[model samples]
Target chain A: MAMSVDLPALEQTAAPRAAAAARWSRYARPVLGLVLPVALALGWELVVALGYSNGRLVPPPSKVFETIVALAKSGELSRHILATLWRVGAGFALGVVAGTIMGAISGYWDFAKRLLDPTVQALRAIPSLAWVPLFVLWLGIFETSKVALIAVGVFFPIYLGVMGAILAVDRKIVEVGRVFRLSGPAMIRRILLPAVLPAYVVSLRVGLGLGWMFVVAAELIGASEGLGYLLLDGQQLGKPAQILAAIVIFAILGKLTDWLIEVAAAPLLRWQDAFGARGGQ
Target chain B: MLALKEVGKTYPNGVHALERFSAEISPGEIVAIIGGSGCGKSTLLRAIAGLDRASTGSVTLDNAPITSPHAEIGIIFQEPRLLPWLSVADNIGFGLADLPAEVRRERIAAALARVGLADKAVAWPRELSGGQAQRVAIARALVPQPEVLLLDEPFSALDAFTRRDLQDHLLDLWADTRPTLILVTHDVDEAVVLADRVLVMRPRPGRLFEEITINLARPRDRKSELFDTFKRRVLTALDRSLDRSVRDVTDKSSAGEAMWW
Candidate 1:
């Protein structure tokens, strides 16, 4: 539509208010969000030192830190972390791509949905770790099995999220597509994809977190060098500090990956933020 | 010419949305279809745009039957319906995807200029105000350079001031492009302000009740007596249609009662 008005002028006038809000969010919110976590860590250190649970099961925070520092000095920390990272990256990528393709196809076409949905739904009920034995038998006790397990873990949330998002798209917008005489492929590309994107991103984060959880399960079977391997090693060697360190690493890594996904999706989600702003107007 | 030859629509569940709805719209003529809720104003417009089909009879543009949505027929629904993902220019240029990039850009730019949103080419639809989004919708509809433009309560959701502003914008557009315009609305004032002739519709088996020609000059004053006269006339016709429908229902019941009496 031809609209000739000067939007920049209006935006310039509104820019200062938006700038102030952004300034507050950029600096303050993250610090505020971190407050509880930092407090909990300090409190946990005090409790363990004060003989809570006899300081054996949980280990003292200082002991865990020392183990982390020792591991870092020997470069074992980097090696294990890198190994886990690679597996998660490979598995998550494969899962999300495949899930999105299949989800979009089934969501848009009734024929595809009819053929694939029932089986996918039934399989989704089976836990990701349940496939560990089967995957190991087929792919062996190597990186392939570990990655495949994580991939299976990641796939379901994304598949379900994308399909649900597509189904939930406003019928009014689809009618707009029909009015424009958009071809079937064109409708899916322009209308369906964008319509489902915000929910798909949320599912991506969920799938990534699930993939991390399954890493331990995958590594429980003949894995040599990952965070999961560290956990098993600490258990076998009877080292509480090492096990605690692995748990800490998993927690931090999970949060970090979720943050990265959100950052990656910010551009796509900008329109939604603008939509909320328009509502206030 | 755009023509509906006794076009009718009956839903699969047996609801008669429209029946024998016929009209002849010459090139550049502005026609408004006004009816109360459930009178099938939107159904008629949808049938004309070929978004929906007639159960009986036919809708034609240039004598070719319209069985499905034709690109040459542009429509503006009640909501702006701009794809939230696209910028204003991209939304306007959406239907023009088959054109070369340069030609499409040129057309988009021209359309933006026409709707007074030339500077908003890169702005997202979410950034636009309700009126602005509606204007973008108008641009999107007009950019395709369609032979017939159909609007279904296009400004009903807007506030009075915004609605009036858009009404003026639409008139300017009609004056410029002169495409055969068919607008469906319930507002009597809106019908009188923009249409060359207004067609009133009756409920139940929706059909045309009467057609009133609006002979006001360009940029018709909403405050003028002539404008009020046309509004009153349309309102009277609307009242007549409602009364007639009610009477028909009572007559049917009374005929059964007469046999028992």
Candidate 2:
């Protein structure tokens, strides 16, 4: 993107100018990653320029931009983003707490792992969307049901990741704890907890993504206040602009939340640098 | 004093790993148990460490029958099992639950310092070289100042030089604090170099074969004349034990007082 800006021509014979030109030339393909997106966006504008697609199937960026403005004016965009964010944060938190406890059981105790694994696997087979009716049936058509739905959706993936991380911990380390004569709780806290954290964190990130997705899906079906519900209401009211506005908000919030987690996790992962396995740069 | 009184172990699969094996380990003795792959050397160590229960007999530390893992016993397995996440200091401090926070920190620092890893107190296990990781493992085991230390071939994964160095390190640790050390190894030289007495075992339906005392001097240099003689004796005992396994296809009762020492 930087290289795309054409510099004013300076000299034809100077060595510095020639060097700058060479660098600019070399950067053309390396900068192609950013250029491709711009090109596609441009090409999308051309489609709108030609009118080969309708606003329904492919709303022009300009129209979507306008929808964003209208939603911002109404304060609806921020509301939806805040609502979705809260649900994902809550759901992700619940899922992590449950997943860690259960994951440790699956990792360390053969008896508990054998007993719980079958039930967990069975529950995981049910998709989050498929559970809408069941959640509503169990908890009624309210925020509780939607939150539960999103939590249920996030729980399994994180649980899977946590269990895998715990399982992936070196058997030798566990044995080391034993040789150190560590008691059960001390071993878990000192040895197992840190050892499995990397995996557990990765699972949480994945769960956050899945949880956000489920939050949107759950809101779409029966929500009255969530971003997904806003989009659905816009659809019912025959307002594509509102729907487009809702989508843009969703995209921004998703990117923002994921980025925030990564930023937050960076400090925790600095131990990576002590090992020099990852500079975490 | 530690003793295995008529110790017998049969795996769930019906493999007779040990049979009526009995031995007394007087205080501060370094005893090596040598056997082929399936020979219950590890099982004997596990029983002593109280990691596993012997089916028909009891292990005793000064006449107290072993029931479960106790702080008085430490066992180093074949692998260096350092937790990847914990720093070297924390790993060395892993089992020191009763220590006050300040005391724990001091002990952890001392252990890491002893292992020459004071500079790497905050380094993760993954940051360490193989030998360094194993040394930390040894440090973790030694930190507890256990009454008995069971080492199940704790240096087999290293190159010969590293193994020899660790053997020296093990001897130094034992010498400094004379914990009842029971080392299990398949390497004849390793057994001869480290042990005051080597117990040989036969494979498959494993039974103790013979007991040979190694009377070489301190740090028992492998290049020394005594080392070769001792290594030959352990190897011969191992070979004869393998032969005894073959002969056991016919004579099961012959594995008698050979184990009772």
Candidate 2: chain B TM-score equals: 0.92
Off by over 4 Å in 2: A1-35, A42-63, A90-120, A134-140, A162-172, A222-224, A233-242, A263-281, B245-261
**Reproduced native contacts, each prediction:** 0.59, 0.44
CA error at residue B232 for candidate 1, angstroms: 2.0
What's the true lDDT of residue B73 in model 2? 87
- On the 0 to 100 scale, the lDDT of residue A259 in model 2 is 85
Ten contiguous residues with the weakest lDDT in model 1 chain A: A272-281
lDDT of 2 at A24: 75
lDDT, each prediction: 0.86, 0.78
- State the displacement of the C-alpha of residue B113, model 2, in Å, after optimal TM-score superposition: 3.0
Candidate 1 lDDT tens digits, A96-161: 998988887888778999999999999998876788889889998899989999888899999989
Cα lDDT tens digits, model 2, B101-154, are 999999899888888889889877767777888889888888879888888888
Predicted structure 2: clash tally: 2
Candidate 1 residue lDDT tens string, B1-261: 998899889989999999887788999999999987888888888888888888999999999999888988999999999998888899999899899999999999988998999988988887789999999999999888889999999999999999999999898887777898999998998998898888888898888877778877878898987677778777877898888644422111111132355
